[model samples]
Target: MSRAITSETKHSIISDFKEITKIRLSVSVVFSSIAGYLLGVESVDYNTLILLALGGYFMVGASNAFNQVIEKDLDALMNRTKYRPVPAGRMSVNTALIIATIFTILGIVILYTINPQTAMFGAISIFLYTCAYTPLKTKTPLAVFVGAIPGAIPFMLGWVAATDDFGIEPGTLFAIQFFWQFPHFWAIGWFLFEDYKKGGFFMLPTGKQDKGTAVQTIMYTVWTVLVSIIPVFGVTGRLYLTPISGVIVFILGLGMLYYAIQLYKKMTVLAAKQLMLASVSYITLLQIVYVLDKFIR
Candidate 1:
């Protein structure tokens, strides 16, 4: 009986850890970082790739854990987040703080082993996301802009990790992901406006999902599409997107824009959800197209 109880306790602890880190979100961030590394490196290095993935996981996980800690009170008021380990009493604030700190330190140390620049950027991402962006969520709608800086860094962080320096390649990667985030996040904000309102987070640009926010979403979507196709012009040096791949990417971008426009026209919860899904698909497909274009060309 004692052994059975011990096993259950261990399982409960593991579940709490996973909840705090938000494993799915961490994995998504790590995926973007790996895609960036693959796009940035001239030749793939498995060792460096592993280090980048591990470092990204730790950094993003720590950020998420700390975010939960900081927002615990507000989280309890929202149905979507009320059951979170930190807010639901499954984990203690002190425990979350200790875990976040340890993970962040370990992540930075591993990244430093890869390259100092990568480590520095990783630390900056965590600091910006946790210290700056999290607190700003309730205060201003511009918080999305601040959050995007760290959110977009992972895509470029991998390149810097592999190359240990900042250059045109990483810059291009950053620009692509940076622009991609506005539409993506705004769509999410549109759909989750109610939940966000409950927590006092002003995520929409206009503080309401009106014509202004819709227009801004479309504008950013246009910019994201334009930037995605720029590599085909052969102006980005080693990053070249062939004419065929460029056309395909353009079509994908148009598809995303169509949904964005639809959301604008309707401005319903359903339309916003469609736009959200489309944005997610657009980003994942864009990354795949980039990788395939690199290999095929």
Candidate 2:
């Protein structure tokens, strides 16, 4: 017997598609790449910016889809992830694989139109994320480090797309985002420790929420703040910031640092959650300040 799909069924399918692609997270990643592009370009090209947004979105979406597929079983074990499309039976592994593959191809092709380096880096991010970082989650806490590589690339990937060159400017951008990930992710791990344990995933620096992890979080937060302000020293080449902008950035870093210190002193899940939210806001604001400073000055 043949059955026609209802409007509710159609909406549910679309919702599943969005969930499988992790649309919101992917869009946030695209924003980072666009910010990087804006920082590097002398003038904006609306066409290229559009292409970068689409390509960046596709690459990140592909990575998330593949990650969901790979971790579907483990995801089912964790309360936070158990309702994701694949684990919840709203989408099948084969369907997710097809979507990921399509996204990967489209992302690479679109980026290649910008430059070979852009395409190459896009491919590398997807490969390292799906092949290396996803698998390492269960085995070691160092997976966060591996994941940071791909996570940080989007910001600098825009620089390469803008100039088709890799140098100190892009390198500095990468360093800022790279170092930021430790404190940010560690805070997330701290608050989600119990949920992650159910999935056998080790995400904390010391493999547990204790003083050691708090200390490491504080250490990395310091490092992230230091790297973020390096552009003001006039050593980062084209990435230099004005005195006023530099002060603003330093102050922003201090705001995040305050929360990190709080996490260290309290060692409570509440403190960790606060730090996590602070870190997220900090990065988005940092990118905005950098872009606005460039144009306003």
Candidate 3:
């Protein structure tokens, strides 16, 4: 009985840890970092790649943990986030703080092993997300804009990690992601407007899901699509997508925009959700196209 109870306790603790870390979201952030790393590398070093992945994941996890800790009360007010580890009473605040501190230290150390620039970017991302973006969420709609900075950092951080330089190539990558986040986050804001309101989070442009917010989403979607093709113009320096791949990327962006337009016309949760899914697909496919073009074309 004692051994069985101990095993159950261990399993529960692991589950709570995963809840705090948000494994899937952390993994997606790591995936973007790896994609950028691949784009910037002439010769792939698998070891550094592994360290970058680990470092990126850990930093994201730590940021998320801090967010949960700070918003525990607010999270409990929203149905979607009410069941999270800290809000659900499954994890202690002190335990979560300890985990976050360890993650921050380990994450920065690991990224430093790759390059100081990468480590610096990772640290900056965490600080901005937790210290600035998280607090600003309930205060103003502009929080999304501030949050986009850190959200977009992983792509350029990877290039910096690989090349140890901050140049036009990585800046272009940063710009592409920076604009893409407006539509991406606004779509989530559109769908979750009610839930966000419950927590006093003003995520939409107009602070509500309405035509104004939808219009902004359309504009940002257009901007994101336009930026996606800039790599083929030869101005991005070391980064140049082939015309063929650029065409494919344009079509994918159009697919996302189609859903965005639909959301604008309908102004329904389903429409917003469709746009959300399309945005996810668009970004993932665009990254894949760029990487494939880099090697093959």
lDDT leader = 2
The per-residue C-alpha lDDT of model 2 at residue 20 equals 85
Candidate 2, superposed: residue stretches over 4 Å from native: 1-5
CA shift at 95, candidate 3, in angstroms?
Answer: 0.6
What tens-digit string does per-residue lDDT give for candidate 2 at 146-241? 999999999999999999999999999999999999999999999999999999999998998999999999899989989998999899999988
Candidates sorted on lDDT, descending: 2, 3, 1
**Candidate 1: pairs in clash:** none
Candidate 2: deviation at residue 166, Å? 0.6
Query: How well does each candidate superpose onto the true structure, as a TM-score?
Result: 0.96, 0.97, 0.98
Poorest 10 consecutive residues by lDDT, candidate 3: 24-33
TM-score, cand. 3: 0.98
State the displacement of the C-alpha of residue 144, model 1, in Å, after optimal TM-score superposition: 0.5
Full candidate order by TM-score, most accurate first: 3, 2, 1
Task: State in Å the error of residue 276, model 1.
Answer: 1.1
What tens-digit string does per-residue lDDT give for candidate 1 at 194-240? 99899999999999989999999999999999988998888887778
Root-mean-square deviation of every model:
1.4, 1.9, 1.1
**How well does model 1 score by local distance difference test?**
0.91
